[model samples]
Target: MEIDELTPAEARIWRAFARGDYVDFRTGPDDDPADGAAWGPERTVRARVLRTLLLDGPRASGEIPSLDLSGARITGGLHLQYATVELAVRLKNCWFEEVPRLYAARLWEINLSESVLPGLIAHAVRVDGVLRMTRARFTGLVRLAGAEVTGSLYLEGARIDAPDAEGPVLQLNQAALGADLWAPGLRARGPVRLTGASVTGTVHLKDAVLDAPGRTALDAQSLVVGSSVTAGCLDARGTLDFRGARVPGTLELTHARLSCPGGIALRATSCVIGELWLFGDGRIEGALRLRRARIDSLSLDPDLVPDEVYLNDLTYGALVPQHPAERRLQMLERDGDGYVPYSYEQLTAAYRRNGDDDAARRVQLAKLRRHRRTLPWYGRVWGRLQDAAVGYGFRPLRAGAWLLSLLAAGSVVYALAPPPALKPGEAPDFSPVFYTLDLLLPIISFGQETAFAPEGPYQWLSYALVLMGWLLASTVIAGVTRSVSRP
Candidate 1:
């Protein structure tokens, strides 16, 4: 574009760019501009100048000058709402008096690293390249709601402090990113919301520190990530909600420290992930809710003991624990109220699939024992009796042993006792073993007990023998039925 075609402000900005001057309010001849500041004319680039450059600059030659307003104090906020920019915007080390607005705008790329701004409002904006804000500091909310980035979104070493404690410091709700969302070393004083956001690559938040006590420190509900969501070494002070999120890769929190006493520290209800890792030095002070979550594999640290954990309906294909089976069993048992039979069943199946039948049986036995403990007093008593007599109907041999012992005792009693008195012209014929068997069998009959009745103490002994026979028979029958009917 020719110089005459530009307005006075645009021309002035063009000339200042030609002279490599930094656009600032105090760039006048009388004023002493800071060292390393641009050598522009004694005039700041007004918002009109910026608008004209972005709207009218030639796109073919890429002749748009780089906005090197580093260390310059922008008097007014930059408003690019609904505008399109073909050039990159670099405002490194700059200070903004007001938050920049880029609502619904399309830009090539943005670089605001090391800048101190009130905040940013870039709702529905489309960036063809990265939205770099590394080492930047924001004093207010940085809203990127519904924005789409074709490249990664970098916020490493950034510090965000929202004015309102209840509001999020960085809001990316419903945003779509073509690449990863890197936020390592981030320090946010308020919650970071990424609700319903979709990322094609990983969401890395390693070594980040978030402080939003009694509220969500990081909320990524319904988020869909193509790769993993890793937060190793993260220190979060409030709830980290990942409800309904889907990740094809793992959701790892290897060395994170979460604290939200009496509240949910991590709530991942209904989430589906390839793998879940809460191993290593991760510690959660509050409850960790994983209700209805579906994971292909889960890895938990042996020593990790959250204050409270809920695992209702939480299904996993395998449990990858470094600890022994006993330790893992203990961990599951510690969930007291949250423990469910299906969880134990799932573990049993996994172990069985791995050809660890012993472990699987042990898990089954533990489950039964735990369930028995949870039963009422009467149920428990019955369970104990079944266990001792028939091993909950699993040990048929035990029932047979009790029957044998009763038969032997009855035989000895009858053999040692005096023979029954003979009637007139009747010969005394008594076989103690046969007599015991006949009485105990109930179906068969021999003349001993019926024809020759016991006298005195032997009569009481006969009644005792009949009662023992009935009890033994009933227990054996019940055990057989239970064993056959059990799944």
Candidate 2:
């Protein structure tokens, strides 16, 4: 750590730090240094000097003096892998010729705000304070895989451009953050990945622009967020995948615009969330898949419509809609695919839990209608018959009505017809009502129709009565069976 043992470049860097002067190698003799202020450097420091300073610098107060490399043009890569530093490293407005590699390094805090860098490779790095990169621009991939940060990761107004189309602009797989991941106004030319990451605070991406068409723009599968994942006014041209993610707080996407035609705009399969808010001018051009997701509550805009939506096995405790019931029903009907029974069932359960039995019944009825429409031709026919005769087993009274009508018709026919001849040893008197009843009742016989012999047209009339009676009996049995089996 002695200046005499340090190289000439290291000595110069130490002297500049002692004098509180910002280092700069890109400034010309004719250029006014005062114009650059604290960001302007008198001379450039070698990469080795910077590394040595970070590794062996003396502590000031309780930490090393803040290393200000603002406006400095670094010659080579700054490799701080596994190095421990106790002070803030400020590289504001600097330009890096090579990507800085900080793999497995432990730092107090690092600020690359407003810096133009090739990229950053900080996999497994640990930061005790904020990783501030506000307004910084990256020309390549910024990988932070397995990183642990005790403070927020700020990337406000940051612009990232990756060379590979399929690679992510920012990779944060398995990263753990103690605070919020703030990235408002971020513009990424490639995808942003956060797979298996855990954020203790909210992940805010308000007004961010992501353009990774035909691919995943934001892949946060299996991410565990302690708070909400809010992305208001976001414009994403590709898919936003959140499969198997768990959010204790709401996942808000207010005023967002997502377009991934012929592909999924958002997929949250098997996710568990406290609440979901897709209201306030949000529009998704492709399918929004929520298969097997468990949401405590859902809030959707009355007018918002995605091109296609899949809610198979999606269970929500409530549907918080500000619109009327009719409008809400219409919105539920917006799913491009045919009727899904679980969606209707989930809604019905929600209404029932809210103590609105009437609404729940209405939803159940609607579910039946929608299900009937999706049935095959033969199923439709059977359904219609059941509806007409027994109200799809919902109103068993209708079957009773049919039976009464058939019985009355049989009585009228038998009464108007000529009297039938009685067999030998039979009763002398003949009662038309008793005769009709005997023909109509298939299970029990009063012996009136069996002892009597009907003539010509009367025989045909009795046959008709018997057939009608059998049909009504079968329909009633079917209705009862259905009612018993229904959930």
Candidate 3:
């Protein structure tokens, strides 16, 4: 308790502090020998205030006034009591097997970054100024509930081990974080319960894992996580019950596995999610019970719900239930077992309510096509026939015109071909066989007056041969042209 009674190291550190040497204190982990005996399996640090403040490195022991441990380690716990130190304490890289209780301590900055605190077995730890822990690790439970953290509290990459190796890790039952509770990569081997805890700013749990009895990674109910609750992936096996919580901006559970007693209950009467994705067996019952919830999108895989889910009074940019029927079975159960079908009638009614007939008709047509299987077989066949006829009716006209043009062209070709004998001025026969060629031509060319104008079957055969040869030549020409153009 006296100046000369202190150890040489403690004397030197106290002397430096008295000389206003704020930046210079004991350095290195071996600066204090008190740590080995202070916080081993047995916890006892009977050393007075001046001894601790003077020569204690984080791992070493002995404390000084306003311990400047910006980057140091304490192999033992720190017991700083009634020390009138301005910028009071800084535990930058400190670890503890157990803690030495403090009393009437007025501390300013406490930096516990990159430090492993096995447990804070202290009676009470209090702080006044900023506590910046950028990447601290806690192996045991830390109780800083009633302590007033005036400035920013940063625990960005903190790892708090489960409290009861069987219970929750860090239980902030009634803690009040004034500024942002920035614990982005904070992992807990047990469930992290912040029920009834309040943070003025944001509570960032972006990539933290909360492992507990029921598989819930993090459990916060009646707890206020400021404007947003942004979790990257939550594996909540037991009920991740958020029954009466309120999130302002968004509760993004994009790729979270949710499980509950009956099923997971987002059933927080009026909680909203900007975008919610139900991945791993994410089933919900008791109404996705968002009495007046709002969301950007609610997406879920059809196979995720093994049984049934419900969405009651929920609103979103789009409520895309992978299996809406499952939700209907729970919430909109009218007429015993029923659901709101996405039918033409419903769609038309929606558009009609909006006072848009064009939109109503469009939606009706879409619904008709989508649920076409719901129609009777005869109705389906009739619809198909009508559709096909409307689409390809003009094709038959083109075919008919081509056939008629071909017949007319064949007649002209027959007339144009050199007749066996000229009639001089008579009309040329357009029949399949020219009668002049079979009768008149033969008599005129042979200089014989045939009695009956060659009216025999042989005469008919001669005319048929000429017509067949002409048709064959025309077909061969057309075939040759088609083959040459084909790719």
Which digits, one per residue and each the tens of the lDDT, describe model 2 over residues 287-398? 8898899999988776665757788888988888634456556656876556878888888787777777667656765676678888899888767777777766667788
Candidate ordering by lDDT (highest first): 2, 1, 3
Q: In model 2, what is the error at residue 363, expressed in angstroms? A: 3.5
* 2 or 3, greater by lDDT: 2
Instruction: Give the TM-scores of the predictions, in the order they appear.
Output: 0.79, 0.78, 0.52
For each candidate, the alpha-carbon lDDT, in order, equals 0.78, 0.80, 0.48
Off by over 4 Å in 3: 3-65, 70-86, 100-106, 121-128, 234-239, 257-310, 313-487
Off by over 4 Å in 1: 1-52, 56-64, 305-307, 322-326, 329-339, 373-378, 394-487
lDDT of 1 at 374: 80
- Top TM-score: which candidate number? 1
TM-score of 2: 0.78
* Cα-based lDDT at residue 203, candidate 1: 97
* lDDT of model 1 at position 283: 83
Candidate 2 lDDT for residue 120: 94
